[model samples]
Target: MLWTTTETNETLAAQLSDELRVSAVMGQLLAQRDLPTVEAAEEFLRPRLAQLDNPFALKNLRAAVTRIEQAIEGKESVVVFGDYDVDGVTSTVQLVSMLRTLGLEPRFCVPLRLDEGYGLSHDAIDRIFDGDVPELFIALDCGTNAHEPIAYLRELGCDVIVVDHHQTKTEAPKGCIFVNPHVNDPEDAPWRDLCTAGLVFKLLHGLLKSRREAEDPRVEGIQLKDYLDLVAMGTIADLVPLHRENRILSWFGLRHLRANGRIGVRALAEVSGIDASQEMASSDISFKLAPRINASGRLADATLPINLLLSDDLEQCKGIAQELDAMNRERQGIERGIAAEAERRAADEFADEPGIVLFGEDWHPGVVGIVASRVSRRFHKPCVILGADGDETHGSGRSVATVNLVEVFQRCTDLLGHWGGHPMAAGVSLPTANVKAFTARYLESLKALYPAGLPEPSLRLSTWLEVEDLEEGLLDELDRLHPFGQGNAEPSFGVRGVVLEEAPHAFGEGNFRFRMPAVNGSRTGVAGIAWRMHGVPEVGQPIDIAVRFSWNYWRNSRYPQVTLIDWKPSGEN
Candidate 1:
C-alpha cells in the first residue's frame, strides 16, 4: 500500500497551539480541518450543547411539533415507523420515549429486512397498520422519497411527518411534514449533515421546549441529555459526519453511554463485553453495540432491539440483549460465508473492471451489504453484492471515496426497482434476469464517470512523528478529538526509524503483536498490534510505521496502544 503524509501549515499550527493551549499535534490536526479562527478551533476542541442551533430553525420542525401537539391534545392514536437500522431503531426509541413522557403511548414498528424490504413500504405499512390506522404517522430515518406510502397514510386520514436525513432522489413528498436537511436546508448549515437520530433529538428538543413553555407538568422532569446515549448510538452508527451538532451530541452521548443509566443499554453493554467502567469510544457503538442492535434487524424483526431499548425491566432487557447477541453471532457467521464467496467471485470475474457487481442466487439478502463492504475495501473498488429475493435480485452497493453509488445507479435506473442512498453506500433491487445487463451497465457507468480509472489506493498519514513522541501525553491530547468517524476521522501518524526491541509475537492469520521502546526512559514499552500483515518487520532494524495511537482498555487497566496501518523499511516511499 502507498503511504501519503498530509501537508500542514507550520505558522497556522503554531498560532493555533498558542491560542488554544493545545499540543503541536493537536494544533496541526485542527489546522488541517481549515478552522479559520481561534473561536472555531476552541469550539471544535470543546463542543458545547449551548452552541447548538435552535431546533425550531430547522425546516418543518415547528410544523412537525404542532401536529404532534395536536395528537397529544386530541388523545389520538399515533404510530412511529422507522427503517430497520441502528439510526432508525434509536430514533424510534428516542421519539417514543419522549412521547411517552408527554402522556402519549405511540405504537412503533420497523420493517423486516427480508419480509418487507427497506423504507416505508406497502407491505410494512399493512403489517403495522393491521386494520388499525393511527391518526398521526411519523417516519424516522426513512420516508424522504416514500411518496406512495405517505400518500397511502394520507388517504387513511393520518397526518404524516418524515424526519429523515437520506439524500432526496426527487421532489419532496407532497401533503406531509418533511424534515430533511438535505432537501430544505442550506448546504453549509451545521445541522445539514445530521442523521435521523440527531434530527429526532432536535425534534424532541423543540417539543420539550414548547411543552415546558405551556407549563406541561409531565415533561418538566424530562431531561434531553438523558436521550444522548441513544442519539450517539444512532449518530455514530449511521456513519454521518461527526461535525457541528453531531460532534456536540456524540461528545456528550459517549459520556452518557459510559454512565450506563439506562437498563437496556447497560444490559447490552454487559452482553457485548463493553467496559462501562471505562470511557466509551465510538468503536464500542460501531463494532460492538451497533452490530448487536443491527443484527436483529438484519436477520429477524428489528422490533426486538427496539423493545430491548425501550424496556425498563432489567431481566427483560437481558433476555433481549442475549437474543440480539446470539443473532449478531449468527449474522457474523453468515456474513463471513457470503464475504468469502463474494471476494472470490470478484477476483475471478471482474479483476480488470473498474468496479465489481456480483450476484449470488443463494446469498442472504440480510448480509449482502456487509459482504459488499468487505469486498470493496479488499479490492479498493466500487462493489455491488446482490442476493436472490424471489424473482428480483436485491442487495447493496459499497463504493470507494472516488465513486458515488447514487449517481452510478441513476444511470441504470431503467433496470432498477427501488434504490436511493448516500454516495458511499446504497441499496438496490432489480429483476434476476437483468443481473447481467445491470452488471454491464454498472461497470459502464463507472468507466464513464472516471475515464482515467480510479486512483490507486493509499494510506494517508495525518502527520509524521518521532518514535520518541509516542507517549501518553500525545495520546491524552488526541482525546480532545474523540468519537472519530466519517468527516472527523481519527488521525494516523507516520513514525520513522522505529526499531523494535524484540521480535513481534505472531498470532492468528498473519497477525502479530510488537512493542515499541519505552518513551523518555519509561520502563514499559508501548504495545502495538497489526492484523493480516503480509510480513513482519525485522526486530532491531529501523523501519517506518503508520499507526493510530489510542488507549486500550482491558479488564480494568488502560494503556497506550498503537494499531499499525502499514509499515516499510526506513525511508521507503
Candidate 2:
C-alpha cells in the first residue's frame, strides 16, 4: 500500500482563477506535490541562477589555496586524483583546465572501476610513486576516508589534500590535509549535500582568488562560469540536493549549457537532441548525459568519457560522443541481463533474510554499484553487491530509506580492509571468506534497528487533481522544479476518475501508451506510456494516476508526456 499525504492548495495555486486560469486539476497537482507555498511555488515555477553563494565561504579554503599556490610557484609536480564517475571526471576536467592555463602541467590519474574500485588505493599510489610522482596529490570526489592509502602517501613524504563531500567515519583519516564539508561541527556548514565537484570548484575558486590578491593577472581570461557546465553535470548526476548553492550552480549551468558549452558537451547535446534554445531541465541531463558518460566506465574504460570532455576537436568529440552513446545502449542491455540473473540469485539467497548480500565469481565490479542500487530499490532493503577476484572481494553498498549503510559498515569494520562512503551509499573491500559472516552480522544489525518489515515508502505527490485541468502554462511552470534530485525531488501529482480513451496502446514492441480526453470544449487527446507497460490496464478502465508533466521536444514539435508514476483502477473492482 502507498502512504499518501493530504492535498490542500497553497495560497499561490489558489491565486489562479478557478475557471479561466489553471483548472482545479492543476491546482490539486500543485498542492499534492507541495508546490503550493509562494516561495516553494516560485522555486518550482522559476529558478533564478543569480543567488548561488560564492565558493570562498567554505572553511579551510584559504589553506587549500595557499598550498596549491605554493606548489605552482615552486614548479612542483601536481597530480589530480579523482573518482571514476561523472563527478570525479568533471572535477578532474575543471581543475586540470585551470592549472594548465597557469603553465603548470597538472597530471591526472583516475582509478579503473574494475581494477582499483573507488577512491585512492595503495596500488594506485604505488604506481604513481613508481613513476614521476607528484609532490602534492589533490584527491577529488574521494579519499576523505582513505586512512591506509593516505598514511602510506604521507610516509612517502607526499602532501595530500582531500576535497571531497562524502560523509566521513567517526575516526577521520590521519596525516593528509582534509577539507571535507562533513568535518568539524555539523552546525557550521549551511549545506551538507555538496557533491564532489562542488567542493573542488570552491577550492579552485579560492586558489584563483588568492592569485588575484597577489596581483596575478594570470587569472584573467579564466572564466569560472565556463566551468559551471561541469559542476552542474556532476552535481545533478551525483544526485545531490538542488537547493541553495546547488540550485544556483545548476540554474546558471543550464544557461552555459545552452550557450558556450565545450565542443564535447555540444556534441553530446547534439546526439541527445536537447535543443540549446529550450530550457533544459534536470531530467534532461539525468536521462541523457549521465548515462552516456557513465557507460564508459560501465562497459569499457572510463578514459573515453574523460578524454571526450577534455577534447577540443569538434569532429573527434562528436565521434567519441556517438561512440559513448552506442556503448551506453550496449550497457543497458548488459545491465538488463545481469540484473535479471542477479535478481534470481538474490531471490534464492535472500529468501528469509532481513537484508541482501550477494556476490558472483566474475561479476563486473564496474557494474556492481548499479546492480546493488537496483536490488535495494527492488527489494526495499539495504543491499550489498560484490565482485570477487581470488581471495579479496570488492563491492558497493546501497541502503533503503530506513538504513544507514555507512554506520552498518562501521560496525562490521573488523572484516573490511578499506571502506568509506556516505549514509546512503558506501564501498568496501573484504576477504572472500568473510562475506557470509558480514552479511549475517549486517542483517542482525538491521534487525536491531528495524525489527519489523520496512515501511512502505511514501510517495510525496506535490498535488492532486482531476483529468480536465491540463494546459500549456501549467507545464511551463513545472520547469521551475529543476535540478530535481536527491534532496528536492521533481514534483509528482495525481489525477482521479480519468477514463482511458483506448486500450493502452502498445508501441516499440512492449512500450505502452494511452489516450485520454480533457474537460475543455476541444477534445484534448493524450497518451501515457511506460516501458513494457503493454497489457497492464484494460481499455476504458477508470484509473487514478500519479504523474509528472513533461515536454517532449521531438521532430521539431513539442508536446506533453506524462511520466507515469503509479496507476490503479479508480472504482472498487
Pick by TM-score: which candidate is best? 1
Superposition-based RMSD of candidate 2 using all C-alpha atoms, in angstroms: 3.1
Compared with the true structure, what per-residue lDDT tens digits does model 2 show for residues 1-573? 373745565554566324225544455544554454545545544555444455566766677788889888998989888887889889899888888887788878787766666789998887656766678998888887788888888888789888888877756677777777777325435445678788777777778878888988888878778898898899888887776667777777876776746999989877876876666667778889988988887667777888888889999999999999898787777777768888888888886777898888878666778888898877777889988978889988998876789878878988887777778888888889999898888888777777886677667667675565455666765564456777667667778877766776666855777766655775656556676442467767777777777787766578877867777788532
Model 2 residue 451 CA deviation (Å) reads 1.8
lDDT of 1 by residue, 43-155 (tens): 88888999999999999999999999999999899999988899999999999998888788999999888877778888888889999989999999999888998898989
Clashing residue pairs, candidate 1?
Answer: none
Give me the runs in candidate 2 sitting further than 4 Å from their true place: 6-50, 185-188, 273-279, 507-510, 532-535
Question: Which candidate's lDDT is highest?
Answer: 1
Q: After superposition on all CA atoms, what RMSD does each candidate show versus the true structure? A: 1.2, 3.1
Error of 2 at 316 (Å): 2.4
lDDT of 1 at 99: 88
TM-scores of the models, in the order given: 0.98, 0.91
